[model samples]
Each structure stands twice: as C-alpha cells, then as structure tokens.
Target: MQTVNPQTILKEKFGYDNFRAGQLDVINKVLAHKHALAIMPTGGGKSITYQLPAMMFDGITLVISPLISLMKDQVDGLNTTGIPATFLNSTVDGQEQAQRMSDLRHGVYKMLYVAPERLEVPSFFSFVQSLNIELIAVDEAHVLSQWGHDFRPSYLNILPLLEQIPGHHALLGLTATATERVRENLQQLLQVTDENTVLTGFARDNLALKIIHNQDKRKYVVEYLRKNSDQTGIIYAATRKQVDELTTYLNKIGIKAARYHAGLSEKERQSQQEDFLYDESPVIVATNAFGMGINKPNVRYVIHYSVPGNIEAYYQEIGRAGRDGLPAEAILLYAPQDMHLQEFFVQKSEGSEEHKQNEYDKIREMNAFANTQTCLVRYLLQYFGETVTKDCGHCSNCLDTREWVNVTVDAQKVLANVIRMNQRFGKTMVAKVLKGSNDASIRKYEFLRELPTFGLMKERTLKELTRFIDYLTAEGYLQFEGAEFPVLKVTSSGAEVLKGQKTIQKRLEKIRIVSQSMNSDDLKLSDNDNRLFAKLKEKRLALAREAGLPPFLIFSDKTLLAMAKLKPQTDVAFLSIPGVGEKKFEIYHQDFAKVINEFIVI
Candidate 1:
C-alpha cells in the first residue's frame, strides 16, 4: 500500500492529528479505484473512510442510507466540521430537493446523502449520470445480505444503479457486523474480488463486557439506574412496548427521560432526540430504531433490558457509549427466557431449511457467551477470531469469586443416562430425569423406572443440572442438535469423559452478596437520600417550567442533589455546585438560598 501524508489532510480539513486504526490504509485503497469493504465498530470513524477520499477525488461522493433522520444527522455533523455536504430525501419538500439537485449539477456539494428508494426515480438517474461521480458509499451495507439481521429489499437493487453511473468510481461497503457468510454475500452483490478485501479486526478494546443473570430484570435495572444517578445513559429494549414501560418507570422515579421508537411520529422523535442531544434529558429509553446515526460524545452507560438476537447486534448497541475516550459501562440483564425470544426471531426469518438451521445454531453460539464462566472479554474477542490469553479483570466473570470442582464423574453419569434414555429427549426432560423430578413429562416417558442414573441423582436442583449442561455445551463436550424439538447429543469429548478417558471441571457461578447497607460508598446514595434529592428536583423542575426552559438547563440533578445534601446558604456556595452556570446562578440563586435557609432554621 502507498502511504500518504494523512496528517496534513487531518490538520487542514478535519482538525485532527491522526487517523484511527486501518483508516489510512482503507482511504489509500479507495482513492486508487479499488472496491473495498470496511468492517469497524460503531464510533470507529467509518464515515471518514469515504468522506476524506471524496475530498481528494475529482467528483461528488453519493452516500446511500436507509434512514432520513440519519441522513440529516450526518449532513448536519459534516457541515459543522466545515465540509460542504447535503442530503436528498423525502424529508425535504419538492422545491428544496430540486434545488439540491440543481446544486449537485453545478458542483456545489462535495458529499451528498440519498435514500435507496430515491435512486429508483428515472429523473434522478439521468441527473446522476450527468455528474462527475467519484465514489458510491453504502452505509449499513449488511442490509444487502439476506443472511444479515436487517435485510432490506431496496439494497438488493442498488448494484444496478451503481452500474449506471457514468464514471468508474470506487464502491465502498461498510457495516459493524458481518459473519463469514455475510461477507461473501457482500462481495458477490457489490462484484468485488478478493484483492480488494479490507477487513479491520473487530476487537473493541475500550468496551467492557458484562452479563448479569436474574429472574427479575426490571428490579435489577431500576436498582442500577438509581445508584448511577446524575449520569447520561441509554437503555435499549427489544420492543416498543418495553420502551414505553421503561420510560414510564424511569420518569416515575424522577429521572429525566424520554422514549424513541419507530412507532412515534417524526415530530415526536425529533423533539425527544433534540432534548437528549442538548442534555435537557439525560436518559433515553429506546428500541433498536433510535441509534443509527446518533453521535453524542459523552454517553456514560448503555443498558440492555433484553438480550439481542445475535452478538453483532449486541456489539453495535453497546458501541454507542464511551465515544469521547472516557470509561463507560455496558450492562446486559439476561434470563434463560431471552433465548426463547431470540429463537422466535430465527423461526420468523425467511430461508431454506438448511439456512434456517445454520442461523439457529449461530444464535445458540452467541447465547453461549452469556452462559460462560470464563472472562467475558475473552469470549467476545474469540468470537471475532482474536485470541486473548489473560483475563481482562474488568468483566463480571473475572471479578467473580466462583468455585470450581471436577464434574468429570457427574458428566459421565449424565451421558450414560442420556444413552440409556435413547438420546431422544430435550434438555427439560433430560434435566428432570437426571434430578429425579418425577414430573408428568418424565413419568409419561417412563424414565423414572430406568436404572442407569434415574433416581440416584435426585439431590441437585433442575436449575443446577441445566446450568451444568450449558457448561458442558460451552466446553465442546456436548452439542444441542438444532431441529424440530432439539435434543442434547453427546460429542466425542463427552463420550471420552463417559469412558473415563477425559475429565471436565465445572465452576459454580458465584452469588453476589447484596449489601444490606445501601449506604455503601459505591452505590453513591441511599434510598431515602435519593428520594430527598427527588423532592428537591421537583422544586427545580417547577422553577424551570416557569422560566420556559429545561430543568437541566436551569440546574442539573447533580446540582440539586448537592444543594439537598450541603444546604448551600449563599450565592457563592450555590455557584460551587456542579453544572451551575453564571446564568443559572443569576436566575435561581435566591430561590436556592431561601430553601437552604429554611432547612437550616427548621
């Protein structure tokens, strides 16, 4: 690869000192007219891959996107960075769009974003053919593959339009997630050969992976948010209904929050989004629809209320935080029921039997990461084909104080029982039979009367036995045959263990000791003190509403909490609270002092 002085361009145009990993190499390849695919995590500067090259090339760069809101956000962001950019989408009226097209013909735009449907119009095609086109960038390019999670039919027809462009401009495809199969589909669809392949390693070192297993997920989420108050964050739910419920719960608890989903009107979505960006609201409860082009820099946390369908989706969702090079948290609250929800998605997708089975198996593998007792970061890296020998120490599992025991004898007995039962039963029945539950299903199968290991293993609970099976699955000693009513199938490793040729060690997951004293320093605040802070916030909100501004704009919750705790009795003391700007001090300093004096005298 040829080297260019990226520093010069970075300083002159983007006001940056250097390029991120693999960015310079990809830019050089695209400028040389080689079609390429770039796979970088979200917030990894994928936009610059095509934007910088557009500046050096001869003609305009056309960016194809799926969301109008995302297009507007990108155009607005680029304009702020001193780049001459525009968008042609339905959000603009006919006259405005026509004027944009006229500007394009006159070479007024260096970068133009358009929706895939807009390319279907013949006039648009004719107009594009008349320009000196430089590059075609397909954002969210995974949508082109049927194997991907979010496939769009419009993307399938995009290649023909690329063929119609007058000049030989380079083609660039970008997405956060692409398995081996999706990568192949992208290459065939874009007609790119092997020589142009550009695969950036998918490891996101800055993110810490955590998985919390609990039956009552809402309770855990509420408790976490209460403890982490005064931080900007986002919570992603799988459905719009869940978003609504979570938004209500947060608001009732006095968190400045809003909801974003496709079910809302465009105006509502815009209003909520503006409030979030301006810090008028510190938390946004949203579905998957809210995060494509959001570029907020200081989001401190991303909490998943449900398990996403695949690891790719999980990675993309969590990538929204820590963009400003600060430490941020990604928390996953999972339950065994989440697997059923993911399986429903696999069953609903369109594919042949073999393809569907393959997708189902992939989901199982992704879920296995959640059930593992090893380091979470190591498991995530290994999924993307990177190896890490040492534990990250930051993940939940590495910090856990779990106990390990040699379950080799137990595993062998379980396998012998499965073979005795003819290897035709699912996990539920197998677990019941192993624990000697004598449930109706097990009794109907008559496994209760078997002699291999039926009633002898009655001491362990069903939950424990199932967890042990998951451990065996993770260790390659067992496999779940994905078919109609999938059942457990012993692998060669399992057979070896059954014959005493191998040993398997099982570690019991550690139980976290819930601190009875909620006043611990780590929790930040006690329940009663939090409620008192909420009361103070109520007064602040009323004042802000009277002033016709946001409560945070008046004074943040942190400022109010400080007031409630320290009882600042003077202007100087009030001004010392966090987020109290000069204007806020001028407006509400007297009111806060009055409250403090009243509390002191009482």
Candidate 2:
C-alpha cells in the first residue's frame, strides 16, 4: 500500500502546481467525506476534484459518466500518469468485462468509470454493491433535471443505486453549464446542501462572440474559413442534411473537412471524431452531438451555421473553443428563418405542456440574443445569472463600428398594418401585404389590400420586411399567439408607436457601415514565434503517434505557443511555463529543449 496526500498526487500524477478556482474547495469537501456540487464552466478543471480524492481515499472511487468516449479518454489520460483507472461500458466484450470485474474485486484499480444506465441491470448493480465504493462522482450532473438543455432520464437511476449501497458514501456532482433553476433541481435531487454547492463564474474572456446576418449560409461559411486560414475550427449546423452538404462543399473547395451526426454508424462516428482529434482534418462540420465527448483543446473557432434553440446549448457549444485560454472566436450566422426551424423542433419534441412552454420561452430568449445590439458576452453572462458590470471588449457588438438607423417611420408602417389587419395574420401575410404583393391571399382579402398601410413599405424586399417583424417580436413590441403556426398581434407599446406617441429605432445590419475588415490577422503571432511553434507542433505529433494519443494530450497548442515564445532552455525554465509541471517536464523537457536549442543556435 502507498501513503499519499492530495498535494503529492496532484504534483506527481497530473503535473500541475495548484488547483483551479473551485477545484481545491470541492476536493477538500470530498476528502472530508461530504456531499458537494461543483458548477463550473468548460475547461475549468472539474476532473481533478474527484480524481485527487479518489487517489487518497482508501476504497475505490466510482465515476458515473454520460458518454463511453469520455470515459475512455479519461482512463487513457490517467494511464499516462501510471494510475490504475478503468471503464466498464458496452464497448468492452464479455471476456474483457469479466477480467475487469475480477481485477476490481482484487483491488487492482483505485477508480472506475461507468455509465448511468448500467445501474438498471440487476447483475451489474449487485456486482457494484459487492465492492467497497467510497465515493460517487456524477459528471454532467445537469442531465438529472428535465429543465436542463440536455436531459437524460437515465440519470434518475443514480440516486436509488447510491441508496442501495450499505453505508454512507460521499457524493460529488459536476456540470459545465447549469442555470440557477437547473442548479436547484440538481441540489434537491442529489441531496447536496446549498452551502456545499460552488459556482465558478461562466465567463470566458478568451472567446469572442459574433453574430452575422447572412442569407447564403454555404457561401458565408466558406468565406469565413478562408479568412481564418490554416486554423482548426468546427462549424455546427442545425441538421444532418446541412452538415453533409457543407462537408461536401468544403471538400470540393480543397478544404479538408469531416461530417458527423446521429445518422452515422457508431464506427463511422468514432472515426470522424478521431480524424478531427488527430488533426487529419482541421475542420469538422457537425451537429450538436459531435462535441460532448471531444477533449481537443486547440479549436480556434466555432461557427454556428444556424442559431441553436436555446442559450444553454449555445453557451456549451461555444465553450468548446479557446479552451487553453488563448484567443478564439465564436461566429453565429443567423437568418430570420432560423427561428422558425427552432420553433418546429420545440413543438416536435416529446414533453409535458410545462416542458414545452419552457422550451418555447428559451427559444424566444435565444431569438432576442441573436437580434440584440448590446455586448454579446455581457448578454450571455447576464443570462446565466452573473452580474457583468463591464463589457467584454472583444465581442462583435463591443467592437461594432456601425451607425444606428432611425427606423421609426418604417416601424410605424409595419405596426399599423398588423393593427389594420385585425392582428389575424402571421409574419408571411403581413410581409406580403407590406411589400405590396398581388398574391391570392392578399387579393381575396379586400380589406387588407385597401388598408392605408398596405404597400407603405413596397420599396423594401419581403426579406427586409420579415426581418423588421422578427426584430419587433424579439423586442416585445409585437407578440405571437398560438401553440402551432403562431399569428402576430400588436402590443400596447406597438400601438403607441403606430399612433406617433412613441419612437422606434433599429440597429439594421444593412445600414451599418462596415468600416473595418473581419480578418484575424490581429491575432497572429510573430514570425519567429510562429516558426518555433510549428517545430514544436511537429515534435508533439510524432510523440502522440508513438504513444497512440491525441497531440493535445502531450501539451495543448496554447502551451506550445508559450514554449515557442519563451524559448525555455532548461528544465527549471520549462517548468515555469503554464502547462509544464515537474512530472511533465521530466518526461518531455529534454525533447522540447533540443528543438528550442536548435532554433536559437541558428
């Protein structure tokens, strides 16, 4: 048996000098045998909380994870530190499962990761009860709540299984993004007290947020990738059809691209994920399912080809970028029609009435977010219950050099038409009436055709008029009524504007002066540092191939960029770098120093 402390295990195993903001507190609570919940942002070091205590505790620590790929990645990373860690899931065969069970009963491993659905199997539950499980850590704990963005019914089985164990065992829950309501749901479900819950702020200043109003999504994405050349990125579409189409378009244009979705076979999905992880293709065009298990840290940007249905999903998706604390960007290509697609999804999902209403509320909030003219980062932070007193100076809104337009005259015309039509039409009919279309719908309704406001906005295109209606809906000047095929109605606030009692202004994208370019040249490193970084990356790729691991597992791109900039020549100097601790330096210092020395001497 080995006698070790948490500090020693952290230093010797993970190669880091200290814990992240909330890690030490949760680790301390777990080591003291108390129930705790940690609400942290992505890349905030949630794994270390339970891992360190698992090493120090007497019996095995059980980790309940959502994805098998995540379990495998964690186990692989732990093996590099010479720690005994294993995973039990459907991916393993019967013989391997038997052997692993035998090894576990013999106390050969300190930690084991299992999926939540495993608890429902009577034999597996009985077998787990036989072991001396000292602690239980739930990863992605937000799945336990129906109010959460990614709800999994399997998570409800965890608490009952924990109760089935003979004695008291510590519980530690971790999630990357949970709203205040979802956090309360988790605490009540897990029996964790409010005092034991720790929330690290949800702001990632390294990631810039941008919303682009583009009609041609394929062309926009292609031009965006071309502008940010030679960088690793992900383009998330709303559906598999769009993903396949974009993948083909990028590949035809000589850009290496891969597509992933639920439609692919398990093997194909795994291969596509691995290709992106290994940098075979620096670009992956995928749906939301592509990123949950991915641990790649060098993704420079994340572009949403269509707006997501809710803010939580959007935050989690964009949080995948700038994971190493380097500069990154999140660009969302939004069109007024994206909202209709999201509404269809919300209506089609299986849920109770309250759940459906909640989903629709989230959709409206997301629409307002995409149509806002305020600081993008501030809007996200505030939505997540953080009080951001200052603006994040890097977002597109914060950096906007556009002039505001007075749309009071046009707004009055649109609102007046909605009123004159008796508030009985959807946006399409109103847009047609405003644009002076001679369609049958308008011709059949003589009253609508003869209204004074009809054709008031004939100079504008239908798309332009539809955008105005969406903007008003998002701003609460207009409201939609109905569960399906919602029709628009005028609010009292809108009536005032129509009567010339109030003014309306809009931050129209078309009127905004594009005085500056959107190129990422400002983020480029110096030529010398770029050369050194390239050499270091080559060495890392070779090391990763020899070890059969992802290159980021050796050292992240941010760590490599630091090495290239500082050009550390000694073990002590290398250890001073952010990602290099004593254990990692001892293993990789000489190889990296050799490369740096060669370049410096030249």
Candidate 3:
C-alpha cells in the first residue's frame, strides 16, 4: 500500500475535483502510517479522508461507527459509486453476516462498516483480529471522550481491542463537533500528538444560521413548511411530547409530516425514519434521538423547535441539512422560556456535581447565543475554540437589515435608575422600577420612587423596557454578575454614556420572516432553470421509487440544479457535472442526460 494523488481519486471515484477543507491533510497523514485525529465539520467529507486512503490500501479499512441504523444506507451509497464496501450489523441475517465476513476476510471489499459494540464481541473480535485490517477509522470520535455531549461507554473498548490487531497500519478519529477538551481526549486515545492533528475549524459557510427570538414556534414552523412545501427538512423538538404535539398540529393543518422519538415503538420509529429518508415524508419532528448518522444529503432546512441542551448537539443537528454542499438554513426558534426547559434537563440529568455545573455552564452559553446581536457564525465558531474575526454574512445576525434607533434618552433613564438602585438588581426589577410598577419590591424600596429616573420610562410597558435592557446587556452597556440570581451592573461603556461621552441606539425590533430565503451563489437558479430543476426532481423521484433508494443518493439536488442550469445534453458534457464520477456516469448517465435533452428541446 502506498500513497498516490488523492485529488485524482477524489474526482475519478467520488465525483469531486477538489478536496474539502481538511480531507487531504488527514488522508495523507494516515497514508504515511501516521495516526491522526481529524476534527472536521459535519458534511465536510470526513469519510473521504479514510475512504480514499482505504481504497489505496492493500487490506480492508474497518470503520467503527456507533450509528448502526445508517450503515446500510452508507454501504449502499458506496456500492452505487462503484466502491466495493459492506457492513456487519444486527440488521444482517446470520447467513448473510457469515457470507459478508467471509468476503471481508478474503479482501473482497476495500472497507467494512461496523459498530463500536462489535469490538467487544468475542467471536467477532477473534475473526476480525485474524484478518488483515490495514486501517481503523472511528466515526463520531467525540463519543470516545467522556466530556463530550454525546459520549458513550462502548467506545472505551475500541483502543483496547485494536491493540491486539496485527495488520492495522494507522488510526484515524473523526468527529464534527469537539471542543478543546474533547480534542485533547481524542488525541490521547488515538495515540496521536497535536502535530498530526488536523482541524478545519467549525464553520458552515453554506448554512444560514438564524435565531428566531420571541416568536411563536409552532406557527412559524407551520408557515415555513407551507411556504417551502416542495423542499425536505427536519424539525427538532426538545421533548417527545413536543414532537408528537407538533407532528399532530402540522398534520391537522393539512401538512403531511411524521414524528420520531425514543418513546415510539421500534417499528414505528423505523417507518418514520424511512419516510423522511425516502422523501415520502418531507419533514420529521423528533427529539435529539433522531439524527446521528442518517446521510440524507438534500435536506433544504433544519428548524429547531426548541433550544438544544448544548452547542455540540445543536451544531450536529443543524449539520444534517445541506450535506451535499448546497445552500441551506438552520433556524432556531428561541424564546426566553427555552432556557427553563434546558435548565430542567440539566437538573434532571444523571451526573456528579461538577458535570451538572458544566451542563449549567453550557446552558448559559446557549442563552447568550439566543440573545447575542453579534455575528451568529462568529459566536458559534468562537465557542468551538476557532478564532474568527470577520462575521459570516450568511447568518441572520449578519443578514439583519434593521436600522438602529436612537435611544440616548432611554439609556440615560435606565442608567440613572440602575445607579439610584446601587446596581443591585437584575433586568426585570430595574425595568419594573423604570415603568413605575406597583409591585411589592418597588413598594418595599420606598425611596426608589422618589428618584427622578424611577418613573421616566412609564410610557413603555415593563416587557418592552426589559427587552431594551436585554439589548443593552447584549451590546456590552450592561453586564450580569452572578449565576444563581444574576444582577445587572452598568459596564464601563454605560459609565461613558452617563458622562455624556457616548450615545445609545438600539435595533428596535426583531426581524420577521422577510429574509427567510437568502441569496447564495450556488443556490441561484434562473426561473427557467428552476422549472427544469423541478422536472428533474420528478424524474429523480420516479427513478428512486423504481430503484428503491433515496433520490439524493441517485443525484444530489445540487448536481441536478447545476445540470438544469447548464442544460448539458451530451454524455461527455453530463459527466462534466460536479457530482458525476466515472461510475455515476456509467450507471445514470443516459437516464439524466435524456432529462436534460428533453428539457432543452422545449
């Protein structure tokens, strides 16, 4: 086994001319017999780092993944691309499992997918140990770290079992989301130093991350689905009850949808999953249990019905959409109450005091995420330890077109009231004082009413004032000081305002759905091209139905959209499309070129 030009293999086999961010570096590290831990974003081609290297290896590259349900689809997709691969899981019958294992032993397949649980099985371990395992690649490698949000104990058996395997040449650990701590743990487990570690950073340029604050989550989701009815997506809820309720409400409103959760029977869950994967159901409402390894790449959007417990889970869930390198969106419908739900979860989770405290810390970070007026993409990337200065123009924060309103008088009123109260209260109490509320707290502090700024903002309601206070806090004019009962204090900038050296202006309103669909270079299709894309979609759906596969696996939406725009008629021209590899052209070349030819005629 030797290293060759990975770019050539990428184009000839995987149907791409360029290697994504960290794919080539990680691939080369392993091909040089160096163990590497690669932290790449979801849908960033992490599989190719190992898959391409495995094709060049003389022996089988065993991929250990925890996602058992997605193994069949992955293996099927590889087989369609003319890459010989197989998987051994509970879904395989005893006879078929034996046959696959025999084939694996005889080097009939370049790669084999297996769950991490297989490493602990005695018979399976004995057989796998005897084979010529050239390389072992662990997918979702964050599960190996105890500090990760989705950690699993089953991953503990991986390194111990691999120690005895003789033919394995190198180890690659791949994950989409990992903090500084998680990366350190993975490097230690993979026995790779930081020198060989490749990190492409956690930034999805193709995803427009939007945080919809203080909106009716259900109504927004329903309307969004109705508007984008022809597209496919997933809506994630915080609880199974929310999933069921949302599913029922959407169906009642004449929108076809399905629900998936751990509470459902295995058969029912499987059916819902299959519906979403095959595009029979355009949308799925589920809890965090739904999307781990399902590779339905054409998901146009992912709506978070509620706030996720941590950034890791949220990023991974949103990463499911636009997997085929197309423009998509991740809209998180955030409300103040979403914190209470996550706080309840943090309290109820089983962990030691330190772990609970860590969960609470993550909750606070998510709270900032929902409220921040800064660049959403920069905030997320910074959370994952990536240093990014420029704000990504794709996120809602960057796309926000609302003009700032002058609020210098309001700021003076708020800052004066905070000082009069000795900066001892939070936003709620301070806002109440400004609004001249008749609440008991205001009454208890009788002298508070005598202050000039106490009743200055009485024209506005308490809720409006509090939201203004929140905006000021997010803008750094105010800061919270405590955890249990956080109290807001005027920041240094606030003092500047009091000294008349600063002027205040606020974004008076939260953005509505006016910018729901953003313009991206890759997603742009002319009106006529869009019509052709729709026709190609119908043809793809029909072909998928006949072949018993998801339409995206046949040809991604990105590829179809490109073909429609270009109107390539010849077989050679069709093969020149971005997603068309040698094998893909060999299989579906005529089928797709005919559609473009027919469309071009009209």
Candidate 4:
C-alpha cells in the first residue's frame, strides 16, 4: 500500500486544485495529530480541513454538527465525490441507524457526521468506543462557547465525549462566524493553543451590502425580484407568518417562490429546501431555519425582509450568497419597528440571567449596525475585533451620503423623563409619558402628568419617541433594568448627557440610500454575457436532473458564467474555469464544451 500526498488526495478525491486560505494550515496541523481551532468565514472551505485528513488517516473521522440539515447535506456531497461517508441523525430510522452503526463497527466508513445529542445515548457512546476514531471535527463550534452567539447546551457534552475516547485523537473545531470573544472561548474549550489555531479574515469582498429603509417592504421585494428574477436568492423574514405571506405574494406575482420554516412539517420543509436547491424555485422566502450548511453556490442575493436579531446571525445568513467566489448582493430592509420583534424574542428565550443579558447586548449591537452611518463592513469587522483602516467601498454607507442630526435636546428630554420616573419604567412607558398619551393608565396615574418632562415631546409621535429612547439606550445613555421587561434606566453616561456635559449627535436618517438605485444588482456581467449565462444554467440544470444532483454539484454558476463568457471549445479551455479541477474536468468538461460550441456556432 502507498501513502498519498494530501494535495494528490485533494485533486483525486474532491477535485479542487488548491486549498482555500486557511484550509491547508488547519489540515496540516490536524494531520500532525494536534487539536486545531479554525475560524474561517462561510464558504471558506472549513470542511476540507478535516475532510482531506479523514481520507488519509487509517481510521474514521467523527464530525459532530449542530443541525441535521447540515449533516445530510455534507454526507450527500461527499458521496457524490465517491467518498465513503455516512450520517447518523434523527432523520434516519432505527433500523437504518442500526445498519449504519453496524457498518461503522466493521470500518466500512471513513467519515461519520452526527449531532451532539447522539453522544448522550449510552448505546451510541459504547458503539463509538469500539471503533478506531482517529479525529473529531466539531462544525459550528461556536455553539460550544456560551459567550458566542447561538449557544447550545448540548454542545457542552462534546468535550466530555471526547474525553471518554481513548488514545491521542485530534480535535478540530470549526465555525464560519465568531467574534474575538467567541474565538477565545472556542480555543479554550478545544484546548488548542494559539499556535495550533487558524484565524482567517472574515471579510467577503465579493458581497455588496445594502441597507434599505423601505416603508413598504412588500412592494420593494416584488419590484426587486422582478429585476433580478433570473438569479436565485433567499428572502429571510423574521417570522413564519411573514415567510408564508412573502412566498404567496411572490408566487402570485408570477415569480417561482417557496416558503420554509419550523412551523411546516419535516417533509414540507425538506421539499421546499430541495426545490430551492434544485432550481425548481428561484427564490425562497424563509426564516433563519433555511440556510445552515446549504451548499448552493449560485445564490446571487440575500434579502432581509426584516432586520435579524444579531450581527452574528446577519453575517452568517448573508454569507449564503456568491459562495462560488462570484459577486453577489445582500440587501436589508430595515424599519425601526422591526427591532421590537427581535427584542420580543430575546425576552422570551429560556436562559440564565447572564445569557439573557448577553443576548440583549447582542441585540443592541444589531440595532447599532442598523443605524450606523459608517462603513457597514467596517462596523461588522470592528464588532468582531478586526481592524480595517479604510472603508469597504461596496456597502450602502460607503456609496451613500450621511448627515449628522443634533439629538442632544431629545436625548436630554428622554434621560430627564427616565430620571424623573426613578428609572423604574420600560421604554414604551417612557415614550408614552413623554408623548403625553391621554390613555387610561395616564389618567389613573395623576402624578405622572405632573412631571416636568411629561409633555415635552408631545409634538413627537409615540413611535418616534420610542425610537429616540432606543437610540439612547443603545448608545449607553441608558441601560435595561432587568431581563424580564427591559425597563430603561439612566446610566452614568446618561447622567452626563443630562448635566449638559456630553453631547448627542444621532444619524437618524443620515445613511439613507435612494430607493430608485437601491435595488441595483451589482454583478458585473453584460447583457449578452448574462443571456449566455442563463442558457448555460439551463444546460447545467438538465445535467443535474439527469445525474440526480443539485445544479451546483455539477458545476457552480461561476463556472457556467465563465463558460458563457469564454466560450470554451476544447477540454483544455474548459478546465481553466475556476471551479474545474482534474476529476471535475474529466467528468464535466466535454458536456460544458459542447454547450459553449453550440452557442458559438449558432
């Protein structure tokens, strides 16, 4: 038997010419039989790190993922490449799962993907102990850190499970999005030293970020879809009801659309996901449930019908677009009222006080991102503790103009009202009191009407006043009293603002992008090239259906676009496309070449 080089294995097995930025480093360290913590952005080839090592090792690699959707997608792709991989998850039945376990015991598998909960089963634990587990790879490893966004209590069991495994087995922890704190916590959890970890930059230069303040999001969504109808995308709403409404509206307007959420049956959700992945629908209106580990690389845009709960979630969701290293867009439809929806969720979540406060703080960061006038990418990077001296010129803020508004007077009034009320009231009550609402509660509390700042903001609407209070709260002028009701209380900074020592300059409407150009699709292809690209996509879809694979698995849109533009006539020219490697060229080059030749000759 001969040992193969990792690069040789990569080209022969996975059909990639080169490893992504952080992939080779992580793989090298893991092959050295050391624990590795890798922090790469979405679509950064985090899977290849452990995947390549698994093929080379003498035993099986155990991959623990958080979502079953993720595990199934990975196993499917690996099998498409002729790799011996299987997943053990709740989606599979008892008989099939037992067969898989039996196969694992016989060393018929090189890789196994499972959820963390599976480790808690005593039978599964004993079964894994009987196998030669060479490495443990934890996907979405941020879930193991309580300080990270999207913490799962079940993920804590991973460390204990690893301890139970005998011998010197390597550990690999991987996540697409993690702040500095999250990264530190993951390192600590994995027990990987700094020298053993890889921190790839989180910037996705191909994604164009846009923030739209559309009062009528439905109309905006329809018109935007009308312009970019040829491209596939995802529209993420904040709730199940909104997902259904958006899906219906898009379909009614002659657009092929689907809906996905936890409210649907498992079969329905799976069907919807397959439809979108197979290009049966060009658009999917869904919640956050739709896009964890989905590998469709041609998503040209990701539109947010409502703002997300945190920057971590927002970044991860938008990353689904342009995953093939082509240009894509991310448009956020932001309204001040949408903040309340996330706040409601934060208040309702089950967690400790510290965890709840962490969530609240994340929400505040999200609010700041919504209202920021600086470079949106810079703001995001800074939040994650990365420094960029220059602005990324692609985001809405960098492309638009922003003006500062003097909100010192409004800030003073809001702080004054909170102080007068002894900071005992929530944001809504403070807004109501300041706006002089003549409701029954105001009538019943006669002393409230006697406060000096009671009616100072009567000219402002309750919504406007509440927004101001929220701005003050987010800016550190006020703090939430407790985790339950989120009452506003003046902080030390709030006291300074009230004493006329600190000034308040808010960019309330400063970073507004004109609605006309707001829906611009920034893909740099020409009309003729786009037409040819669309035709190539049809060809790819036909091949995908014939092969029983997703369109991207056959060839990504990026490759098809290249074929359309370059009109590759021979196998050599076809192999030059970015995603085309040795094995892929051997399998797919002739078909793509025929498509290009026919198009050119016609």
Model 4 misplaced stretches (Cα beyond 4 Å): 1-3, 93-99, 346-348, 442-448, 474-481, 489-602
Whole-model lDDT for model 2 versus the true structure? 0.84
Residues 325-443, candidate 4: write the lDDT tens digits: 99999999989778778878977888888998888778777877876667889888888889888899989988875567888988898888988888888888899899988798778
lDDT of each: 0.78, 0.84, 0.84, 0.84
Model 3 ranges off by over 4 Å:
2-4, 93-95, 406-462, 465-505, 510-602
Q: Candidate 4: minimum summed lDDT over ten consecutive residues — where?
A: 514-523
lDDT of 1 by residue, 1-602 (tens): 12546567677878878888878877887888878988787888888899888777768999998878878888988888877899987789999988988998898888989988888889887887898888989999988997776777667886888898987788899888887778889999988776776777666666677888754676677667778877888899888988987787566545668889999999999999888888899889998888887889888889988888778788888889887768888998877677787788768877678667766776777678778888887887677656678778888888776687888888887888777777777777777887877667876876456756776578888887887777778777778886546888888989999888998876665665653312325336566557657667877888988988888877776667666666665554565465665556767778777766755565
Rank the models by TM-score, top first: 1, 2, 4, 3
Clashes of each: 0, 0, 0, 0
Candidate 2's residue-wise lDDT over 145-259, tens digit each? 9889888766787788788876567899999889888999999998889889999999987999999885467656767788877889999999999898778757755678988
Q: Write the residue-wise lDDT of candidate 3 on 1-602 in tens digits.
A: 85567788899889998888878889889998788999988888898999898889988899998888778878988899888999998889999999998988787999999998887899998988888888889898998887788777667877888888886478989999999988998888889999899999888889999988767676578679989999999999999988987787566546789899989987898899999989999999999888887878999999999999889899999999999889999999987677778878877777676676667667766776777888998989988998999999878888878987888878878888888889888778899888988789889888888887777889998878977787777677887775445677899999999889999876667545543222357568989999999998998999999999999999998888788887876654565566775567778877877877888888
Q: TM-score each candidate.
A: 0.81, 0.78, 0.74, 0.78
User: Residue 523 deviation, candidate 3, in Å?
Assistant: 42
Error of 2 at 281 (Å): 1.4
* lDDT for predicted candidate 4 compared with the true structure: 0.84
RMSD of each candidate? 9.6, 14.9, 15.1, 14.8
Query: Whole-model lDDT for model 1 versus the true structure?
Result: 0.78
lDDT of 1 at 223: 69
